[model samples]
Target: MLLPFHRQQLLRITLVPLTLLLASVAIAQSAPSVIGTRAVLTTWSDPIEALGTLSADESVTLSATVTEIVADINFRDGEQVEEGQLLIRLEDGEEQAQLRASQALREERRNASNRASQLQERNLAARADVEDSQSRLRQADADIQAIEAQLANYQIKAPFSGRVGFRNISIGALVTPGMELVTLDKLDVMQLDFSVPEMYLGRLTPGLTLNTTTAAYFDEVFSGEIATLGTRIDPITRSVSVRAELDNADGRLRPGMLMEVTIQQRVRDTIVIPEAAIEPSGDRHFVMLIKQSDETTRLAQQEVEIGERRQGDVEIVEGLAAGDLVVFHGLQLARDGLAVRLIGIADDETDIRALLEADR
Candidate 1:
């Protein structure tokens, strides 16, 4: 029974000393731990943004020229064709028969003309007979040419080298004149068209470089140069249209794809700081800028005018200079004028999460 009482007293006496020792240790570490970053100077540009659309380098819709029954389809859907390649053949049996007849008449007239020329040279035929034979031969040649020209109306050929679209007509289907057959597009280069306000006309011109982004290829940036400028501004909207050409060697960009365009403008050197350092109060913004006085480092509430927020960084318009340090993390425990211990400097290459876990 005496040993138990002694043990209790011993614990009570050691409790006070242990509490004091812990208090002293915690007080020594009471200075808030924070992660800081230095403000940097970098180039910034104000870019002009606008919406645009992409089109093929050359696009056309093939159509029928004469009302006739479809005889043959030479090309399939989505097939690449060469210039002057036959795409379709309409039924032309009557024209073909006429062509053959014209050829035979031409051959007979040519033989007669040759025979008349020989007889005239030997003085056995009159000059009038030779002239008549030559006239008939020329007339036959004209008839053949006229028939061949008419036969071309029944055939459809590709006007240029490109990829063909869907086949609209089948064999034996009667097609009328001016009826749409299929579409063709040359996709080696793409054309982009956008509009800009008239006020920006002075800054725009041919050969200016621009970049475009689309939802289909979100991470990819397509670049091009201005090809044309609008001759007149739209009186109603006060905007002018602009056209650009983009190289589509991979054939990824198709016709009618909507794009967002960006053009670079004025560039300036500005001070930038970590975005996480900003503290919002009501409608204003502030940062806990690290200050050094004598041997102690303290924090001060510095008001800043921010311009643009970029990837993990922001442009500081005022109240900060290059090489200035600011507390980026541990802001919840920060207080103005309080002494702080710099645990780490947040580096651009280092991940923020790894830094936080290490401090914990």
Candidate 2:
């Protein structure tokens, strides 16, 4: 048999190993598995969204200036017209006859003036006679010009190149001054009008890019740049009006269509993290950051100031740096100073919505 001291030494050695084994088992059970992602420097923007209305770059309601019977309609409904193209012809037979008569009179007076000048040069007529003849010829020419000016009023023409809307009146209809005939719209480009809260007035400026969407074309995104801004702000609404211009080569956007406008006012390169990584409590936000110590990963609770939250990402304005790893999944299992096992580093191309759904 062994001595009692030897037996005691053997028991102590076996118990020490058992104690270490128990300690390791406890650590493994306490540590939580989490998915983490590194904070990256990315361009982040503060987007301003508002309702807007689309308008033609140039629009006008064509109208008649005088009451007269429409003799002929030169253009079809919804026709594209060029500038100065004839649109309507009113009854001008009387005016044409008068113009012809005046022209004939002018020609006759010019012949008489020439004869009188020749007689004066041959010493057969007085200077006063020649002067009188020349005056009559000038008066006839003036009458012809006056008749032509009146004739021009009876015809209607396009003022600019644009697509014409449907005509309200047909041929032989009497149109009065200021009567609506059609609407002409320059649709090669579009104007978007919107109002933003006066709080963003300082950020308003020309050349700011805007993205717009409409209910009619839900899949299409139209882009434009700020063309103008209203000079005054509405005190009651505390808003300012803004206008942007978009190219509509496809003629998809129409006037008076409601559009959803989005303006990216400020963009900056900043530390960005997944929105799931942030834990909000009361008025403060905290993130569980993964810190490595003694060859083991642990959670470090960090308070961060967030600037903007956009789509699945949050801008970290303070208390975070690029390349820092943060826990994006299993937040409930994470505690400050507790050990953690990194199950995986989230793929940068992974859809945030998918991750959220998985978490759910």
Candidate 3:
């Protein structure tokens, strides 16, 4: 070991250089890392909000046309079915017997008609007898056709392709004419119906795009377009009926689901910045802008004339041009002429800490 005096001298020499190195690092990082934002020109619109209800594009309540005992149920609850697919078969024992008997009689009559016609062709049978046999055959055909039509009434089939509702009746249950059995809905596309006040009637038109959200899928935004508008406003509510259609090929949205709707209209182009960047000073609004000169960048306070404010953005009408950088986050460093380092763009998606670490 060296003497204490010599050690003190060496230690002082080493610590002095070490302190100098640390001081240099601190000077390099003197400028705070801040997430910067650039003025962006974007389309602006006036948003209209309304509550709506969703419905299947095609829906119907399945029921029977005639009173009969249920013979068979071909579908389960919530089953997908095709058009003309048989769903229920009522007891048709009597109709089946009638059909069989009519078919046999028609065959016999046809044979007799053929023999009579053959005899007439050779001039061996009377004209009246041949005509009588031919008429009998025609009558038999009509009788069979009538029985077949009656039998069709005993069967219930789907009118369109869709999912079937809950089973309302079981096998052997008695159903009457027009009795409610089940429901069928085509869910590939959904229809949303809402009411807008007559005050905005002049702006209502077909093909206007709208966004809708439901409580069931809060994070999901479904887009649709105006399909139609009611001809007359409701006298009581002073509101007009509006219908919009949305594609629900995934079947997440169901009939009778309540949704919140927003429609955008009267689009205009404007420059916008995050609302957090604005600083209020009595009647004036100011923003901290990043000014870059060669390799040095500093903050400058600018008074900007603002237009409409929507959501989290404020429209700048004056004192800011497109591509001008502004400090969106770290507003605590609001001192004018303060130096700041540009770490990253503070877009809506990026996290502030992540930006600082990436730049560091």
lDDT on C-alpha atoms for all candidate structures: 0.90, 0.90, 0.91
Which has the higher TM-score value, candidate number 1 or candidate number 3? 1
Q: Model 2, stretches more than 4 Å misplaced? A: 1-3, 279-285, 292-295, 343-360
lDDT of 2 by residue, 165-219 (tens): 9989988898899999888999999999999999998997999998999989899
Per-residue lDDT of model 3, residues 1-360, tens digit only: 657998899989999999998986785588787788989999988788999999999999988888899999999999999999999999999999999999999999999989998999999998999899989989999999999999998888999999999989999999998899999999999999999999988997899999999999999999999999999989999999999999998888999999999999888888999998999889899999999888567889999999889889999989899899999877786578987777788776879887767775
Which of the two candidates, 2 or 3, achieves a greater lDDT against the reference?
3
Q: How close is candidate 2 to the true structure, as a TM-score?
A: 0.87
Strongest candidate by TM-score: 2
User: Which candidate achieves the best lDDT against the true structure?
Assistant: 3
Cα lDDT, model 2, residue 119: 96
Q: Which ranges in model 1 have alpha carbons more than 4 Å from their true place?
A: 1-37, 266-270, 274-289, 298-322, 326-360
Judging by TM-score, tell me the better candidate of 1 and 2. 2
lDDT of 1 by residue, 1-360 (tens): 456888989988999999998986775488878889899899986677899999888999988878899999999898999999999999999999999999999999999999999999999999999999999999999999999999999988988988898988899999998899889999889999999889999998898889899999999999999999999999999999999999998888989999999987666899988788999898789999888777567899999999987677888999999999999888998899988877788876867787777766
Question: What CA root-mean-square deviation does each model show from the true structure?
Answer: 8.4, 3.2, 9.9
Clashes of each: 0, 0, 0
Q: Least lDDT summed over 10 consecutive residues: which range in candidate 1?
A: 23-32
Q: How good is model 1 by TM-score?
A: 0.73
- TM-score of each candidate structure, all chains considered together: 0.73, 0.87, 0.70
